[model samples]
Target chain A: MIRLLEHEGKALLGRRGFAIPEGALFPGLPPTGPWVVKAQVPVGGRGKAGGIRFAATTDEVRAAADAVARLVIGGHDVRAVYVERRVPPGREVYLAAHVDRDLGCPVMLACPAGGVDIEAVPHERIARVAVDPLAGLGDEDAAMLARALSPDGPPPPALRRAVADLYRTLVEEDAELVEINPLIVGADGTVTAADARLILDEDAAFRHPGRRAIPEGTAFEEEARRRGVIGIELDGDIAAMMNGAGMTMATLDQLVAMGGSVRGLVELHGAMARGPDHLAGVVALMASLRPRVLLFNIYFQFRNLDTVAEGIARAIHAAGPGGLPPVVVRIRGVREAEARRILEPLDCWVTDDFARACARAIELSGRPVLRR
Target chain B: MAILVDARSRILIQGITGETGRAYAARMVAAGTPLVGGTSPGKAGQAVEGVPVFATIAEAVAATGADCVLSSVRPAAALAAMTEVFEAGIRVAVLYTENVPVHDAMRMRALARARGACLLGPNSAGVISPGRANLADLNDARVRAGRIGVVSKSGTLTYEVIDGLHAEGLGESTVVCLGGDPVVGTGFAEILRLFEADPGTDAVVLVGEPGGAMEHEAAAVVRTMRKPVVAYVTGQRAPPAKRMGHAGAVSGAGAEATTAAAKLAALRSAGCTGVDIVTDVGAAMVAALAARRGAHAS
Candidate 1:
């Protein structure tokens, strides 16, 4: 899931025929007064984290914007700030649409209790309606959601239209989540999205070319993105690389179980599509961590193991002696003999046994093996 | 007999012109998996490894009476390819493509259920009925057909568990990889039900990881099962919110549903012998199956 910044999310909502606050990204503020300076971060609970601040005047807005731009919320640097025209106190409601895994469908959630923490609200106050992927959100579903949010009386047509539009944005954008915390119902019955959060489905990037512009979280992430692999940094001393995600996590679990820690993990997404050069680059990137032991727990089914073995051999040769950490490899499947033959010259411990490879990695890392 | 595929199961390879597809086709043919035909849009009338190729799944099915499809299409073409398979009345499909859109996955899953067919995965390693059909990404030579039914969320984790089981002189009746997506076509409960009804399967090994409530749902099924289930839940020490390679293997904020400890506890409460360590999975399965046999004998 790639989280869209506040401006980007609001722009999308606005495009789908929803009302958004008059706002602009920092350095280009809206012409009017009484603005809310919000630090543009992907994470939630920013309001509680001092990421959102109110400014009464233009001078105050500039000051708040500067403060927000310099702040780091949720470990993410605040590169941009959203300065929006602050709406007056009104009926604030929580409205969100997300794909519910258990329900196996898109679900729209609405609550009369809004503007505040929706998690703190009682279960009875929140109304959830599962949107049919086939039929989509019907008029009745929209009306029902409106009524659920405003049980005291009939909700205005604007609220109903907003609900419909929200559902449309969720489906049309291929977004995993589209949330409007504190969807302000003004005194004049106009509904405006005060804050928005949208997370687009990363897998659907083929459909949306604009998704390529989203920034990576870290330098390692950026490099991994360029290399077409998934690299996550940790604080441990063992660098683990694997072919699949499930295998990567399981390897981490096994390593931790043996009293070893992981400094980083590099997952080979489409290892076969990429040749040995890519794998060699990935191995080089993993070596940059200077881990105590470079652990490779790769199990391939369709892809050739020899290519990976060649890549490992190449990476080790390029790194030279002592440039890389002591390596422990557990490779199997698809030309296992050729892979073994290729890696025969490398100064590494190679085994088909998963446990033995992990134990060896830990022992090489100087971490005490805790036998269970 | 195995729950999904057997020697009689006629297999069709979708995207057979591609590298991965051709590799799988060769392997399946070598294993004598009854590879009848394949489908590749515009590449129709061509053949890969003696297997006839058609323009559509319908054409392939008409020619070979293929009951199963192994799709290795690109991510963008996965949904359309699977739709064609389902429309052609194929009852079982193993989508080997990864990074498929969640919406497309949901649509494929819904269609599969509506057709009363089993869709293995959008990011799955496919399924392998050892000694019968080698549809999965597993090496057929290493896997032996036996009594233990294996179902897992991760393909690599399944390989490890299968190795451990083989080390203990046990083998799988049917190994199902439910894919590592947050939402999958086949869940643990559905597979467990199939394992329970299979006469060849004496015991079950559930290789699970922290993430999603699928494990808990599987535990609910385990509560009513007559056969013993030995479970190994991984990702115990993984940091929160970091996706552990698999898109579904992340523990979200305050949600214990996907935590390894919670999954193990839930399975144990449902009478499954939960192994904390992945290596101990085979021994636990042996002990659990032995306990069940002792009770039956007494």
Candidate 2:
């Protein structure tokens, strides 16, 4: 999921014909008097973290932007501030559209009580409708959401249209989530999105050529992304490499349970499909973490183990003697004998038993194996 | 008879001209898995390694009477390919594409449910009923046909469990890779229900990971099953909020319901034995089977 900044999200919504407060990314201010300066970060709880400020004058707006730009909320550095013309806060409501995993459908959720935490909102206040992916958000469904937002009377056409357009943006943009917290209903009966949080589906990036640049996460993550391997860093001495995500986690759990801590783990997610050289590059990247022991717990179904073996051999040859860490390999499935034959020349302990291999990795990491 | 695919299942490969599709076709044919025909749009009349190719699934089905489909279309075209498969009355489909848009997945799942068809995955490694069929990614020679049924969210984890079971002198009746997606077409509960009714299946080994309520749903079905269930929920030590390779394998904020610990507890409470270590899964399955046998003997 690529989380879009407030301005980017608003711009997307605005393109799809949704009403949004006029805003500009600071160091430039919007041509207006009253403004809300918000730190443009991907995470939530920015308001509570003092990342949001209200200004009534040009000097105050400049000061607010400066304050917000310097603020770091939720460990993310605020690179920019979103300055928007402040609408005199009226009835605050919450509206969002996202793919609900449980419902197995695109769902539209709306609540009359919005500005506050949606999690804390009373169950009765929240109105949700599962939009059929085939038919999309129907007229009845939009009206139902509108009624839920305004219980005393029928909702204005603007609210209904906004709700429908929000769903449109969510579907058309291939977004995972599009949320508007405090969807403000002004005193003059105008509905506008005060804040936007859009998460585009990374899987659907092929359809979106102009998708915003992905923010660099951790240094290890950036390197992993560049290398096309999944590398997750942990605070331990053992480095583990596995074929799939679930297996990687399972190996980590088993290693940790046996008194071994993991320095990092690299998941061979289709990396081996590119052949031995690509796999070697991934291994070289994993070695950069400087782990005490490198553990390979690979269980390939369709993928040949010989490819992985050749990759490990290439990585070892590239690193030279004593440059690489002590390695323990537990490989099975698809050309196991051939893979073992390829790795025999390397200074590595190869086995088919997962437990023994894990124990060896822990011992090499200088940790005593825990007896149950 | 095997649960999903058997000797009777006439298989068709969608996107049969693609690299992955060609690989699956060759393996399935070599394994003698009743590979009847295939379909690749604009590649009609082209025979891929002795298998007849058609332009669409309907044409393939009409020609070969294909009951099951192995869909290897790209992520962008996966949904359309699945629509073709389901619409052509294909009862079972193994979607081999990964990274399908979540909305597309939802719709595909809905279509499958509406048609009462079994759609395996949009990211799935597919399923295999050892010796009987070779629709999955597993090399048929390595998988010995036997009585214990296997269902898992992860493809590689299934290999680990299979190896562990082999060490305990156990083999599988069928192995289903549910795919590691947040919203998959098939879930643990559905597969558990199939294993429960399968005469060849005496026990089940469920390989689960941290994240998703599929395990919770599986527990609900396990509570009613007479067959013994042994479970290994991985990612016990995974850091919270980190996507551990699989898109669905994430420990989200404050949602303990999807955590590995919680999933293990649910399975245990449902009268299933849970293993803390991955290698111990075989031992746990052996114990559960022993207990079931003891109950039967009495």
Candidate 3:
């Protein structure tokens, strides 16, 4: 999930007719008398990052922009600065919409005290509503959220309409997160999404290319992608290969709990669909993991084990005994006999035992599998 | 007593002409899993692994009385496969395909629900009632039918757990991998409900990873269950969710989706025994069973 800066986020909101402060991302400060120079980064806490500075004079604006642009925090590059006319202080409120992984729908969360960290808001103080994709967020729900934020009365028709439209834009754009922190409802009672931060899911990038063109993944992700293996390097050393993501992660967690270091993780969900060449790629990749012992713990519910076995066998043949790492194979599910037959030739200890498989992996690595 | 499939269940294989469907058909037949028939749109007049082939689910069901289906269609063709099975009135289906479009998953899920069919997965590893019948991506030779009901989000993890149980001189009543997707058809809670009702299932072992609320939802159900459930949550120290193979593995913005610590806490708070290491899963199940026995005796 990549975070869009406040300026970009607000610009999108403004384009969608949401009340937003006009902002511009400039390499250098505009020749102006008054402006706020804020460091442009994806993460929050920029104000505390010593990156937010106000400049009343044109010369001051240039210097502030220059300073803010050069500041880097938390490894995020700061090459640009946001210049905008500062709005007068008013009651700070917050609104955010995101996909609730558990409920399996979009959820809108709001709180009246928003300028502060949203995380700091009391759980009960936060009001939440689920938005069904099939049925769009209706008027009553938007008005309810507005009322929750403004308990005294309903938000004006314009603000209510804006809120509803913003929610619609969020769904239409296929966004994972569209947050407006300190959605200032000014003393004059005008509501504006003062800070707009959006995070769009990369998986849905194909449908919404306009705002969803995800930047190339990080270096680690790119490297993993090239291998056709799901490589998630963690703080441990016992690299593992499994058929599914949940299994891969569970193995890593188990190894970590057992006090073994896990250097990498690979989930071959569709590798069974591929042939020996795919397995060869996996073996070569595992060799790169530099694991003291590679764990081939595969459980197929409907996939053929022979495919995994063949892949491992071919990879071992390609790597040769000297190049291959000490390997332990714990396989189950359909085509087991055939898969084990293939792995047996590669000196892989084929077992249908979970503990034994893990023990072998740990033993070969000369490590203890910790328990938690 | 089983929730979805049992010893009496007859199974049908959809997409039986495909390489994957054929492979599973051979294994299921070899395992003596009450193999009935298969369905492939244009391969109706043939036989796969001695199982009669029909062009449609209705014909296959009529010919073999097969009430359960293992769908092995491609992602793009998943909906059509499901529609065929659903229309045939199959009571249970395990969709073994992944990367299906989200819009398709929703529509298929709704269709399955409307038909009162229990759809295991859009990316599921299928379900196995141990020695009774096997209709999943799992290795038939490795699983032994017994008392423990193993439910997981990963097929490999389910195998690992089943292997652990085998080493302990135990086997599964049924092992179900709900699939590793955010928008999967079946969930932990629904599977737990099945385990709670399965007379053959003495206990349950739940394996989950970071990046979904399914585990947490299951934890809530476990709090009210009569059976014992042991859970293992992965990605404890997993550096935040990294996008790679599975679409469901992506971390949603929540404490429940991306953090193992949070999931583990929820399980524990819900009164379910939570273990961190996969290797300890067997021991946890044993302890849960023992604890249940002690409580029963007292």
Interface RMSD values for the candidates, listed in order?
Answer: 1.6, 1.2, 3.4
Best prediction by lDDT: 2
DockQ of each: 0.67, 0.78, 0.40
Q: Ten consecutive residues with minimal summed lDDT in candidate 3 chain A?
A: A212-221
Instruction: Indicate the residue-level lDDT of A29 in model 2.
Output: 73
Stretches > 4 Å off in candidate 1: none
| Model 3 residue A271 lDDT score | 52
RMSD of model 3 against the true structure: 4.7
Error of 1 at B162 (Å): 1.1
Question: In angstroms, what RMSD does candidate 1 have relative to the true structure?
Answer: 1.8
lDDT of 2 at A93: 88
Please, what is the whole-model Cα lDDT of each candidate in the order they appear?
0.86, 0.87, 0.76
Q: Model 2, which residues run further than 4 Å from truth?
A: none
The prediction achieving the highest DockQ against the true structure is 2
Query: Could you tell me how far off, in angstroms, the CA of residue A225 lies in candidate 3 after the best superposition?
Result: 1.5
Worst 10 residues of 1 chain B by lDDT: B249-258
What is the model-wide C-alpha lDDT for candidate 1?
A: 0.86
Show the colliding residue pairs in model 2: none
